[model samples]
Target: MDSPEITEAMDALRRRLVPGTRTILGIAGTPGSGKSTFATWIQQQFGPGTAVVVPMDGFHLGNAVIEGTPLRRRKGAIDTFDAGGYLSLLRRLVRRDEPVVYAPEFRRTLDEPVAASIAVPADIPLVITEGNYLLADQEPWKEVRAQLDEVWFVDTPQELRLHRLVARHVSFGMDPAAAVAWAAGPDEANALLIQATRPAADRIIPWEQELE
Candidate 1:
């Protein structure tokens, strides 16, 4: 997780890629560990080759499913997402066929996710697929890691992650106290689960730079 090792991992991942690779980079980190931010940063750094990001959040079940199922209590739990759909897209994404492929995007404002938000043309050399459960040992999640060419796990301090999570929830309209409670309760519990997968990552990034 040191700086040198982190850069080396990134460099090695870059070296394996060339034009027409359609490389799938998997990034998993606990909620508030900055998975989306880091993925966006990497995409921006990837230059103009159409490197797109397909977040696992896009596969979250609709409101009805969440409300009616046990997942309603733990909205961001490991089992809350539609792992099958995510696997399906990943399987298709790794294919070497021609034509464009559209990936889904999660709409946080509506608290509902949608499929096929981005049209990923076949020419793109890299696709960043990030989420908290990519390395999860659960049935389908364990297999999810296999589809990725390179997988990096983001490791953030527990205290900082809690702070970020609380702030994030508050920004989304929750009261400050409620945000902290949720972050420390369900959110922190999820972070513990994600940290258990750290040893499985090809690279671990502590993310000490330019993050609040």
Candidate 2:
């Protein structure tokens, strides 16, 4: 869908592209709002050689680290991520110094981050990073905003978002009832926190309407 909102975001990122420098575009939204999908679409629009997506989910604290702790229950919460490490990676991406930078990828089936799974080459002019907390007003998270050329918040309907979250959980091995519980519980809580940061985004895309 080449909607105006999508086109505008594309143009904004295109403007940031320079001969020797890289531009980082951040797509933030509540869980299940399709930020990752949107980021992928943007990458395809720009072509793989020109744009690559480096997700924040790759920084999630491993299940082993959260096991036997309260974090295990709130696995997708803000504190469940390696904020410092993500910030460090963003800094490196902004500097554009390396020939190739490897990034971690989150595996939903394993529920852990696989190290060095994504490779961001120096020639790629645009890097699109999507996640739930890119606009979060916290220590290292706020620093994440500084490294991005532009941050767009994807706004999806709450009902649609919750439905997507439940379906995602079920697809990933949770029972139907358990998926519903999770969507209404931890995921909803995270969604609320993410939504609160909407005012800070450079652009707020009505995802359901625009992307449909």
Candidate 3:
């Protein structure tokens, strides 16, 4: 499960660590591109007490807030997130002054973000965050990128990504037909947007190799 991309990233992160400061690494990719998996792998490689993961999905707006709006249909779109709040969390994580910082977690089974579900202790030196919009060029997202020490783009095949998205939705209780439709529609749109930000990444990791 090792690759030159990951090895290089690990070396880079280790070099960036200082006694009192924490380094933040971002993993960005299209939906179903395995950003979360990759981030977790990186954290595991770094070992316990040295690294932690904080996902951007936790910033997703609650269904209640989106239910009466057009965003309900486009649930995963950029506008459906609390970009400003996410930015605030990143800033707080950068401070590294608190005993422990609690971050929210998104539960796919409940389709909601649970408050203070993940804890980042001050002593942990590496923070790995993964999401679709980490490299986005949009307003608050542009600011979001500034908080990270380095950002890696997860490159995955479109066919595999789409297939994964369909399976993911189905696993979460969505109808097969609706899952396929969403994968082709809103998911594809968001994927394209994510793809556009690939050039901004510090590195591109081919996800297929990691999958194997």
TM-scores, all candidates, are: 0.93, 0.96, 0.95
Model 1's TM-score against the true structure = 0.93
Clashes of each: 1, 0, 0
lDDT of 2 by residue, 1-212 (tens): 56698788778777777777788999999999989888888888765589989999999998889999999999899999999999999999988889999999999998899999999998889899999999998898889999998899998888888878888898889999999999899998998899999999999887763331
Best by lDDT: 3
lDDT of 3 at 136: 86
- What shift in Å separates residue 92 of candidate 3 from its native position after superposition? 0.4
Comparing candidate 2 with candidate 3, which one achieves the higher lDDT?
A: 3
Report RMSD (Å) for each prediction in the order shown: 2.0, 1.8, 1.6
Instruction: Tell me how far the alpha carbon of residue 52 in candidate 1 is from the true structure, in angstroms, after superposition.
Output: 1.0
lDDT of each: 0.82, 0.89, 0.89
Residue pair clashes in candidate 2: none
lDDT of 2 at 191: 88
Name the runs in model 3 displaced over 4 angstroms. 209-212
For residues 79-103, what per-residue lDDT tens digits would candidate 1 score against the true structure?
8889999998888889947487887
